[model samples]
Target: MKKFKVSLLQLDVKFGDPEANYSNVEKYIEEAVQDKPDVLVLPEMWNTGYDLERLETIADKDGQRTKTLLTRLAKHFAVNIVGGSVATKEDGKFYNTSYIFDRKGQLISQYQKVHLFGLMSEDDFISAGSTLNQFIIDGIKAAGVICYDIRFPEWERKLMSTGQQILFVSAQWPTKRIEQWKMLLCARAIENQSFVVAVNRVGNAPKDSFNGHSLVIDPLGKILEEGATDVEGIFTCEFDLDDLKAVRGNIPVFDDRRTDLYF
Candidate 1:
């Protein structure tokens, strides 16, 4: 079986502080690279942690800065990157956006969060993405989505419909709803019969607390790696494409779907 190693960097993000957060992320990435994982993952809002009010001034200008840095890192290390979501500024509007890069440092896909957490006033500060995200890395079909987007099974279904075998989620989920975060991730993996690699931030914002439970789950809804709360750590896992195929074949949920009669 062919296996790929993935590293998830679960770190605490300083609220409203991009410089400090960037330095922190850089340090973690350096540490994660020592293991020579095929892909490096980061948590959500790593650039400017939930500082909605200051996003206009603090957000990455069209994500150029993040792309440049990630691209350079990917090329230098010769590894793929699931660059976490950032507060992105474009056309005078802000958005929660994610970027992915290939081992050769090629930009593959970028996803802007579609579902804005109205409870957090995300609707007020960010522009929602209008398209479904699907991309390829090393000939593997993959999809990228933001935090709140995970609640909508239809979105994950759409990605699965496109033959996505791996789902990458980046979130700044609150500690109060940590259980939902974990359950939903497992559900997505089980329902879609795909690998789920989710990275959530740790630490507290002005009004909310985040408990990092970043996890990598296999197709059978088994956790391969999980992170601890209030700490910085690298959780690594090796996934086999053959194993995913075997699990899906055993269950065959996708083949058993009755889509036309449902909706």
Candidate 2:
């Protein structure tokens, strides 16, 4: 299908509490399935919100549990899931990771957050990822990234240049800079000529308060749907791959790039 619907979970995470978060996740996922969107997106660190010190204690072990839950949900609901970023532990180290499950519940993509936000002390607790994640869902090419990656346009362009039509970002952005979150997502969509689907969490953690400003933006920079700050719910939007082609064809941003001049 050239056009499809997506539902975002503007969910809330309990700091250092995976059990509570899991229940919340289940409730939201069940509710989101009611909309029967082709894809479901969620926030970064939804499993444990910025509970850095508790990484070793609370992180998902090798992401097995995360995969199991997402897989079952995707299969049962018949929906693709940009499963969002979660704290995961592997080989005695922790990483912020994002997982994607196809409609069949097959794990399609796994992206560990490459950029660790120094301001949040992420650099101290989590190991950085060195790879990019790009995959196809129902024949549509897409990419997934964590919260801080939005500030780096080159990363988004890297995927868009390689035929990615949709960009999914999952975040646990604090309340202080929610405006920047909205602006950046719109800018990414407009600049890349692709649909940007960003899901953010709401409520508070130990050190920060999250504002749920999850959004879906079209290639022309239009805010298709947005969630309210500090509210928990599902926000859904629909878009067509044809729109990406139209935007790219009209501006030719990629075709007109001066690759030879960049430092």
Candidate 3:
């Protein structure tokens, strides 16, 4: 079906505490599934909130715990899951990673955050990812990226070029720059002529306090649903992929791209 429902779990993550976060995440997922959304998304760094220094110790080893938890939940609910960015360790190196699981609990895709936020000291502890995140979920072409990746349009363009109808962004954006977060999301949706579902965490970390303005935007840059600032709740919205044809046909942005003249 072209029509699909998406839900964002705008949760408050506890810093450096994977066990508590795990319990909280499970509770949130149970709450979110009540909406019966086809796809459920979580915020960036949900497992460990910018606990950069302790990443070597706190990061999920091989993402085994996260994978198992999300997989079981996905299968139980019969829902697709975008297990938002988590701090993971592989081969003794840490990375901000995201996992996607299909309804049957099959792992469809995994992406390490390509653009590490140097300002947050992410580069010092977490390794950067080099690959793009593109996949299909619930019969719809979609892509997922972490927090800081939203600032880079070219990277998003590359993913959308594949004709993905939905772009899922998992972020832990701070209150200081929340406006930019909203603007950039809408801009990406308008530019790509694709749906944008962004989930940001709320509450405070050691240094930064996040404002959850989780949003669901249409191809036309219209807000389908938006969460209250700093509220921890599930925000659900429904839209049809069939609408993309009319939107893209009218603008023809992708078709008219002059790739040869641009970088």
Candidate 4:
């Protein structure tokens, strides 16, 4: 039950410009690695912030560029990375994809946003991803989900039931719904008895203003570390597996779940 340190890259993403966003990510990664964190996380759509109309044009082609940089940095820093979601184009279709890299710089998992936000018109532009992926990070079972995906408790529970210890969420959630983001993520952790490490972007977009409340919540629903609403900075925190065991042992939510009644 060793403790793991995490560094969250909470930065504003420029709308409709992949080049600027990529450059910003590179600069932030440089700063983040300096801390020598055990793991690094980024916000959703860091490459192109909800530039839905231009996704077909501005999206990363095959995600090669993003993969290259994330791989290089992960290898260089020898840190595990839960790369935030990026707008990636493949086979003439666009998807909001999240990539994961291990300390060895190997691509571990890729999850597209399974639940698209119709309110933001994401359904109109992006193809929904179908697979739920699980991987190991620093010997911890982990998985990544996009912004709106957290709303579906069943989806999160499904993954958690499959031995997922850490749930990494990358979001461009609107300021108006920051409360929902906070409540839902805490609920996800409390109900599932797992650590929830979520990162949200700060600053404004044409549709909504994002106030980064990037959070690191323990299985007991305690906010161990939280980012300010408008600040763009790297926030780091540490979590130990002992926390998970203590909480789960006390609550026994997983053991007490009514499996027969769960239809």
Instruction: Write candidate 2's Cα lDDT for 64-152 as tens digits.
Output: 88899999999999899999988999999999999999999999889999989998999999999989989999899888889999999
Candidate 2 C-alpha error for residue 258, in Å: 1.9
Q: How many residue pairs collide in each prediction?
A: 0, 0, 0, 0
lDDT of candidate 4 over 57-134, digit per residue (tens): 889999999999999999988989899999999999999999999999999999888999999999999999999968
- How high is the CA lDDT of each candidate model? 0.89, 0.90, 0.93, 0.90
Runs in model 2 deviating more than 4 A are none
In candidate 3, the residue pairs with backbone N, CA or C atoms under 3 Å apart (3 or more residues apart, or in different chains) clash, namely none
lDDT tens digits, residue span 8-70, model 3: 999999999999999999998999899899999999989989989888788999999999999
Candidate 4 lDDT for residue 217 = 92
Once all C-alphas are superposed, what RMSD does model 3 give against the true structure?
Answer: 1.0
Per-residue lDDT, model 1, residue 150, is 94
Best by TM-score: 3
Cα RMSD, each candidate: 1.2, 1.2, 1.0, 1.1
Query: Which pairs of residues have clashing backbones in candidate 1?
Result: none
Model 1 residue 116 CA deviation in Å: 0.5
